[model samples]
Target: MRRPWGLALLSLLAGVAAIAVALGPLLASSGGVHGFAFSTIGVGAILIGLNALRRNRRAPSAGVLATAVAGIGAGAIGSVAMLGMLVTSPGGPTLLPFAPAGPVVAGSTGQWAASTTQVTLTSVAVVGVGPTKQVVVGNGGSVRLAAGYSFRSATSNPQLDVRLERRVAGGGWTATGIEATVAPNAPLTAATPAYSTTLATEAVQYRFASGTSASAPVSVVYENQHLYTGMAATIYADAAPYCPNTAVEIAHLGGREAGDYAPGALLIRISTAVGVRANLTRASQRALALHECSHERQWLNYGGSQEGYAQMKAAAAADFTVGDNGAPPIEHAADCGAMALEPNGYLGYGGFCTRAELNEGARLLNGQEY
Candidate 1:
């Protein structure tokens, strides 16, 4: 009797295809190749074992029995691996049976709608305001959040309550007393009224929630105004677009340099002279901020502080000069990045950066580095 080699080969090919699919980033999410490979290999082994068992069933050979045992073992291992992967993978299928005794409940309502019903918070933005003339003179300010939500339901005119939540210091979310009701009557999409609140010293996290659904949180950092004043604040704000998360600080550097970035701390410290130079003209200030922020971007592009520092140190060592005529590669790259931000504006090291440096700076800013 001929063995079922064709079927076994097909199963093996299918396993290989599964592995390819898993490895392809566009093909799968969350679970990587290992899980898919293990599961598929186990299934293939089981199929091969079953084919071998059937082929010699009339007079079962030792080889057939061994193959069956091996197949069962592989299947067991694959099942375990698959279960672990699924359990750990976010938004993946579950093996546990979900048997509901009653209709699914959402929020406080028992109005069971089809599974198609969904409420999603789509967009969120922050608008900040300085102190008003009518208000008492102070350094404090306020910010208003505009949140938008979308809803869909199989049932007609399904309504849901959207709530704005802020993360508290206790690592839990609390409602900000901002709520809005949305239904299909309003065409299933609406923007909630702006929720205004006083600014805090630290950055705040906020999100919009509707029942069990929630939007991704946004962090509002007010450090630009709260931590900095005068020209420092202006420079920080100007540089913010280049590196939004990097913190800016004004300090006395005793004429060492215009500005310096601490990659480990993700902070940019500007010399008092830089701020003074910045106050001379808006273009100069913007150029200075852009240069410092470019350093932060460089750190980000090189991965993190450790790798960035190491690579930058190597580049600096290979360079000839740190003066305006010729600076280190890192400084040259930053100057080039500043040029990328303000192509027509005054750059401190404008004459030093080469065409390649300018292109590299632009590439880093655009996240096009391969």
Candidate 2:
């Protein structure tokens, strides 16, 4: 009995072709032009694949041409996915530097006052890059970690502590302990209580307490020798605003720093002045990016899609008495985008922007005065 090799091959090719069809939308959302092209080919492949399967059941050789086309489509999709990853990876393209950089080291001197100290970082370096891993911000001066995560275990316990953690491969950071309670108001020699917990860590977090004036500057030292890697630090703005008529490149932002106001979104760009800030942390930057892009999306979607509706919202939103009844609904949506994208709320970029922030984001998105 001869095995049905031809039928088996057809099944394999069909399965891969289906995958390309599914990945098409994801690719389009992630990269746009390149994605769209890949998606079109993928769709075409599915059609060819169906025909090939039909012919395969009749005469295997009859499906050869279709199978070849299907394979090309599958290859096209795979190539696009790889290209998108490379283009967005950190240190890839500057304009669309989508990948987050290394983790940010908060304590310059590894010392935080006996107050509330919280640092949300990206990762904990498991590999080696530098020697500035353990951050202990003490009184007088500050300690700084270059941009990665590396820690030394603590020897004893104290009253308060600034915990640290490492980043998980998926996303978000988690904490275990620092081997000792780090008293921010007591001496390094001071010991309060003995706490014990056996847990491994991935990401890092800083914890600070409030309502205490014991005059004990926190003394944090290294405990373990493990180093965290792939953490990204803050990235400052390189250029001004994206001059609408300009092109994009990797080495250059061709835009502004801090808050990237494409001089505000579409219509907002027309009515509102640019509102780019400086010194925004990565979290804030992500939030701002999400908010602004939401505007651009809505504008291209609703405004461009329906000029009459756009005119009505533009006119009604100006009547101070009525304000904006979701006019250019993009405003409300942009706020939501900011809330969703922001991780640490550094600069109010993430979850739940205040009323003021919502208004501002919405205003800019609506192309109104802010």
Considering every candidate listed, which one attains the maximal TM-score?
Answer: 1
Q: Residue by residue across 93-168, what tens digits does model 1's lDDT show?
A: 2121111121111232526443445665544543211111111111222233334444334332334666767674
- Model 2 alpha-carbon drift over 4 Å, by segment: 1-64, 86-140, 147-370
C-alpha RMSD values across all candidates: 15.0, 23.4
**How high a TM-score does candidate 1 get?**
0.38
lDDT of 2: 0.33
Off by over 4 Å in 1: 1-200, 203-229, 275-279, 312-326, 349-351, 368-370
User: Which 10-residue span in candidate 2 carries the lowest summed lDDT?
Assistant: 231-240
- The digit string of per-residue lDDT tens for model 2 on 15-85 reads 47545544443442333344445445444544555555555555455346455455546645655554553
